[model samples]
Target: MPGDGPRRGDAFEHDIQVGALRPAFEAAGLELVEIDWRAPLDDFEGLSLVLLGTAWDYQDHPREFVTRLEELGERGIIVCNPPPVVRWNAEKRYLRELERRGVAIVPTVWLDDAGHGDVAAAMNQFGTDRVVVKRQVGAGGLRQHSFSRDAMPDQDWRMGRPCMVQPFLPSVVEEGEYTFLFIDGEFSHGVLKRAAQGEYRIQSLYGGYETDFTPSAEDLAGAKAVVAALPFDDLLYCRIDMARLHSGELAVMEAEAIEPYLYPEQGPGLGERLAKAIVARL
Candidate 1:
């Protein structure tokens, strides 16, 4: 099996996700080869499973990147979560599609550019007293901001390029956000992510913290339904991030299919389970 790359640093040296999966792959008689996702297509041939590990640069060059992935797929390499699913889920626009399907989601507004018009009016539509402005395509909370109407500049309302605006749900300060992990469409484990004091974003790389969480039955049911409704069956892994709405409804914040942190440290046998799932598919 091939894992996606720039396989450097202590990111995986003590990483729970890597620690769990590596031994299991070895026991299952699979060679886990880590390759740079941007390397020549020849590097990906002969792989049984290809995971799009950590290469944020691929997002910047998605067209050329996915073209290479398509080539590999055409040659019969089983890319976990699939190239199509990765392409679709990479953008936050999928939230609109999910909302259309009756799944509850955080209130969101899409803007074309950072300077179109009427940011206040859009924020009002969501009844947001405060809101977050973020890039349409981003990771690690880069370039995201939380703002009250008074804090927004007049030029910030433009919509020339796609961007996102979401009501800054304050529940993040109390209950935090929950991320549920799934393997082969089944619940594996979960983590609770807390933004740093007085901050709204909950990415560990952005000063957020996480711990193992035991989800409620409702949480599990809602999460499973969301996964079931996704338009794919061959997914290898997924992370469903959720936060509670003011009215107490669970709302999806993000659905990560590519390169999401799995927090394998939370469970004793998670790595073996993931390995078995992949082996079963092979």
Candidate 2:
């Protein structure tokens, strides 16, 4: 992991999130504190809630992360999205479940270990020349690959971990990804994340950028439907990421229930909204 750009996904994003939420949390008589998720469980004592904020490295220590959250929840601490939800969301295969539950998502082929041969097969299966392969437990576009039939990896090249393969969607590059943030099961705001030129991943770490967006009624309804499809009914927060499919419907790219960046810049009222929701829960 040497030369990895930053310890977290985006330093500026973390700063903005804290800046926006801290004053609002204070206004509601709450104090905001940042803690390492690996800290002693007793360190979480006396906290009314843990937002799972900025645990960006959790993908590398997935079980530990979820176990820690589970322990916190067992101690009666409020863990936003909760441990169970985090566990379910940790694996990308949950998309299959969402699809089964009537949520439209990018068509994906799950693989335990994907090599060049598998990539070829996936492209054949999806009937597309270009495809994307992503770790089942990844974040911030880390360890993701985009391949075209003409530019396949060598035969021995393998993604030595569980992953999902999907046909490369032109909409990702043409229209960018859409993020809908929800607070207490209600839509809070929308952000359009555009990848850098020549890139397909719409994460800030990859030079992607965000802009405030107001979706049309049909698209907003599509995002809300994804939220409604989540198995848990008591979620405190969710970020539903979607992309416009060729069919003109917004299909889910991700249903981020764990530690998603809420575009505070796009949603200036995010702080107050979060504070109100947190206070109501207490």
In terms of TM-score, the best-performing candidate is 2
Q: Compared to the true structure, candidate 1 yields what TM-score?
A: 0.90
Q: Which ranges in model 2 have alpha carbons more than 4 Å from their true place?
A: 1-6
Tens digits of per-residue lDDT for model 2, 106-142: 9999999999999999999988999999999998899
How does model 2 score by TM-score?
0.96
Q: Each model's TM-score, in the order given?
A: 0.90, 0.96
lDDT of each: 0.77, 0.90
lDDT of 1 at 189: 89
lDDT of 2: 0.90
